[model samples]
Target: MPNSDYSARHLSVLEGLDAVRKRPGMYIGSTDSRGLMHCLWEIIDNSVDEALAGHGNQIDIVLHADTSVEVSDRARGIPVDIEPKTGLSGVEVVFTKLHAGGKFGSGSYAASGGLHGVGASVVNALSQRLDVQVDRDGKTYAMSFRRGEPGVFDDATGISPSNPFKPFEDASVLREVGKVAKGVSGTRVRYWSDPQIFIKDAVFASEELFSRARQTAFLVPGLAIGIEDRRGQEIAKHDFKYDGGIAEFVEYLAKDAALTATWKLSGSGDFNETVPVLDESGNMVSREVSRKCDVDIAVRWGTGYDTEVKSFVNIIATPKGGTHIAGFEQSVLKVLRSQVEANARKLKAGNDKVEKEDALAGLTAVVTVRLAEPQFEGQTKEILGTPAVKNIVANVVSKALLEKFNSPKRDDKSQAALLLEKVVAEMKSRISARTHKETQRRKNALESSSLPTKLVDCRTQETAGSELFIVEGDSALGTAKLARDSEFQALLPIRGKILNVQKASVSDMLSNTECASIIQVLGAGSGRSFDLDVARYGKVILMSDADVDGAHIRTLLLTLFFRYMRPLVEAGRVFAAVPPLHRVEVINAGSKANEVIYTYSQAELEELLSKLAKAGKKYKEPIQRYKGLGEMDADQLAETTMDRSRRTLRRVRVEDAAAAEAMFELLMGNDVAPRRDFIIDSADGFERERIDA
Candidate 1:
């Protein structure tokens, strides 16, 4: 189990690009199609870096028939001058040496996708054949490499990677290929992936290339990217150019109806970091420097519940989501939650805190941060490791959103209000969904025993024939239990009025004892997840008193049902039990017993009295008025309100849901002006005798 004889003899030093060929996965990530694509990306990213530096606005990619990919860009070409350190041409040093390029503190590029300086050299080491041409200094210079060796291919037989190759004996030659017009400069690179290092089936993917090109074009506004595929039987070409930047990218990625316009947030911040610098003597040294980070974000909300966020650093996609994404999400949640909390009463959020998912629901955003030599976690560069960028991005986003929310412009104000309302709605929806799930699970785990304690359950097992009567108070519940048909009618009692759910959040409704008990008793879910088929009873009858206060309580119950369990009302299952307001006793002429008549309202009582008087009948002087359901005896309650054959039940119907919702909101919502105006407008048609004063 132990190798005690291990020594320096066991360690062998690899020179030039030999280390890369020995451990290709260490550089390219894998030996499959993904690794092959990574190598292609290394070359394409070099060209993209040039475009990002504002030197070029066009880039082209070609997929050759031989499976070799080529990338050309109208940017500053690779230097042709001799490198002082290596005593070789700049092209040879860049392609042969590891971690050698012009991007390391040369100030040649302000912000670029490549930072490690190993992209070109690593790609060269992994390619069976690589050819690079530079059009600069009014002349075209060409160089070729056969597996990281400076050489020339003898393509006399054919232009293939299997052609004879000769390495430079003493010195490498940089051949002058052709002449170009003055002041024109660019670079073109074509490379064949090494068969020995990659899988045989590894090939360039045209769709991925096109998508990358299009993304690059969008990231670099005004930059045109053209892709041509010669590998296919029919040559295909695609071109992408966008001037709207990430905003257009957001629009292209959005899949639902927009809830808000695309918003742009742009800003910059400065931070200090200590990094290695190349000294004059070619030694590595660490020095602290101040760097500016530019941030640009485009975001829009839609009607869907999905979230789409694409983040990048220096035009390179960070798909795994690093510090920058964290910061962006943090800022979004914080800002939106703050705004929602500030407008809680207006939106009726009612003590529920907004979560990150709520803030991100229906959101589509593109987050970009640009800085010099940002740290990446791996060679693939899918994640950013720089910690300072998080705070910087968060600061920028927070400032931008705060300004928008506080802006006095009407458009900004309207959007801000709507955004807050949407976030609150998402939060409520999430709560409702969670409660529904919990209710389902609880029903399965505890069965019928989990129902509320005060409920007087029906004896019948059939749901279709069972009715649930929501009585006003314990007094009414006692009489209802005695009067109701015990075989199929259940009783649940509530104290006074339940919360006005039209002005309450889902969490608040779920927390209210009466509301929660009612929902639990029904055995069906609520809100978007309400399942009418799972309901424990077919009819949900609200039984209160026969007076004004009872009417208010009934209205509250109706609001709860209409807002949460709306399907029950729409399916014609929700009803209000009408109790008699007056009981009139009439004396028969001689030996007949006195007859009792029940009148539901003053108008009905007057009509009954008029009819009785015209018929020359004598009755008791005093008429009994039912101030509450508790005042009725069991027989009277059963005959007047509980019996299915004799009772009058008003079925709640939503002929026009939109109008009903507006009416409910005007009466029970937190806003008071509309309700006040309604009362004032109806005052002209008031009748004093109709009031239950």
Candidate 2:
């Protein structure tokens, strides 16, 4: 073994680019999907940097054959001039060094994207090959690297057509450079991600790209962006340009809901401020500080359920928002409470009148701040940790909002005031409702906790991978209870009817004996008290009959699970047991007794009849479709849909959350007109066979 803590060993550090390839995660964040995309994003951000500098607007990203991407932007090419201090060119410094880029100094860019200078160099270090082309003055320069390739390509003729690299294998991807084109210049970067560095697939997702592209288009007004995929898939190609910028972006967000007021008074609830990072403990503390900073505020209050606040440190979304989010919340609370005391009514509800969740409810807000040198938590840059920015932002928002709410106007001030007042009233209602609901739930939870007397509860509690066979009626429940794996499976025999929590209030839902029993048995007491961790079985299987009533019961159960215990569905814990519609056995000329039995779907049964006609086996199979679960005995239920080894369970998955939400809202919400309209609209195109007969 080496000597403990040698001073000589501490002095030595890995030279050149070995450090990055060895630990790529440290620089690019991770070798996962996020980091793999970040490798490409670094190059794209450079182009975005140029666009920020007023160089060019057009940018083209091409996903190549080998899953590598080629990003070409028409922005001003990176400066190729030799630096006075370092003999190497600026491009070399940008590629090789850690924190070297134009964004460091004043002239490079003012409002640029990405996490500062570390982006490009980190990407280059990780990439197996990075090829850069710069058009400067009357000359065009090109350089290629195979992971810091030492030797240089001398007299690179990019202006000439003879070179092999000039005419790429894919001819359509490359466009010839126009020499005489004035006021148009930029650096085009083409690079392949090293599989050795990133473990995640380098393949890009159009969905992820679409989100970023949409956000960028909204930020930069009137900028058109064209996108295409690897197989030249040109679907979903729409420019998300907003003439009104962030204002229009807010409207787009609020497009799905009802807005009480029209005309965005400002950016919808986006309060941001650029504050100087305090480092008094460091040597830089003594430096003169008079950096006048600003927080761009855009606010809009809409009538909605969830409060959506998106914040950014610079152009990047701080998903795990830092002090900025905290500060914004603090300010809003302070200002709102003050106004409530001074100008608003006392209202009916006391403790429920004011709550944290209540205050932010229905407030769709966005807060983004830019700093000289932002302190990020990690390379993925999900959070902004700078202490000063939050305090500054909160203070600014608080003061501005206080003034705005306090000082009312003639025409539009009333609208703004009314919105604020609505925010307060909503908060009051929410608080009172929440408190009242919680008190009732607590009382109910205490009153009844164990599975109901009607349900045959299993013995054991450690029920992960266990099955909860929700059999219809007492007859099927009796069979399932006798056949169930008592150690892992539980039987819940639902009565003739159960309450639909969707159409019922919290009180009514709690009152429903069947639903409440289920809440207790699952160990996750429902409504506000439901915790996914407390689930009795990992697999909650609904074993209904193959009849119309069974399907209706299944839908009702699904609706209950979706509305009240959604985390179960989201976690992939909910499942529908697929019982055989037809049980046919060939016990005649060619087949043995039990060996020739098989199950079939309705379509499959029809196909079987057709096949029998074709084959000339005209004995008439006489298939029996099960009308109820009781038709099948304990043994049949055990072997087909209840047996852990042979059961076919369809795991419910929500492909489109928004669409599913809309459907659920239409079918279940209090609004009858929307529900009626939905039925009317869907009835024309509806497939009658899908629903219960």
Which portions of model 1 miss their true places by more than 4 Å?
1-14, 442-446, 449-693
Query: What lDDT would each prediction earn against the true structure?
Result: 0.85, 0.63
Model 2 whole-model lDDT (C-alpha atoms): 0.63
lDDT of 1 by residue, 1-693 (tens): 012322222112125567888888888889898888888888888888888777788889889999888899899898999998777788887887777776779657777775378888888878889999999999999999877777789989877888987766667789998999998999999998888889898878777787887888889999998888898789999999999999999998875457788999999999999999989887999999899999999999875555889999988899998999999999999999888888899999999999988899879999999988989998778899999999999999999999999999998888888788878987887777566556543233236465788989887877888899999999988888889999999999999989988766666787899998888788677765577888888899999887778989999999989878889999999999999999999999879899999998899999999999999997898889888999999999999999989999999999997678678878887768988999999999998777762
Task: Encode model 2's per-residue lDDT on 123-164: one tens digit a residue.
Answer: 776766677777666556666554543223332654221123
- On lDDT, the candidate that comes out on top is 1
